[model samples]
Target: MKLINLISPSANLAELTALASDDDLLLLRQDAVYLVYQAALPFPGKVLALESDINWRNITLPAHIRAITDAEWVTLSANASQNLLWS
Candidate 1:
């Protein structure tokens, strides 16, 4: 799956639009609304947003796209980092 990290205050929506493909994952957080609002792609893959983000009001996501928490992402990221480091 393709992962798009939306951690920038000024995320490029166009980048997501261009990167979106079947089975691509779009992770939204911080100021990601800048791009989430402009997402016109079908987003066949998952679109995950931070549960604590206030930007959710700016856009509408499909059922496939769900909200997650920063803690969850951190845990996942940490696990991935550990695996990479151990390897």
Candidate 2:
């Protein structure tokens, strides 16, 4: 079965990446924005981000990482969003 992983706040990309396989679709959100700039794993899925998010302006993400708007994500559960942590 195809899996759709919604990675929001409180989720670690590294840990998720480890668990994720080439078949799994990893959806990055919130602090997970950092993953966009990093190297792409063997996982053959799309890495999406929110266009209105501040991270989109601060980070230089790879082409593979698509920056979508809030409305877009809202329309499809296929997309996910999250809040960044600050401590």
Q: Of the candidates shown, which would achieve the greatest lDDT relative to the real structure?
A: 1
Estimate the TM-score of every prediction: 0.51, 0.55
Q: List, residue by residue over 4-76, the lDDT tens digit for candidate 2.
A: 4344444554565565555444545566565565566434555566665536458766777777667766554
Writing each residue's lDDT as its tens digit, candidate 1 over 1-87 gives 445666664544555566566665566666664445553534555667777774455556556567777787676565442211100
- Worst lDDT run of 10 residues, candidate 2, spans 78-87
Error of 2 at 46 (Å): 1.4
Taking all chains together, the TM-score of candidate 1 against the true structure is 0.51
Sliding window of 10 residues with minimal summed lDDT for model 1: 78-87
Error of 2 at 12 (Å): 6.2
Q: Model 1 misses residue 81 by how many Å?
A: 8.9
| RMSD to the hidden true structure, all candidates | 6.3, 5.8
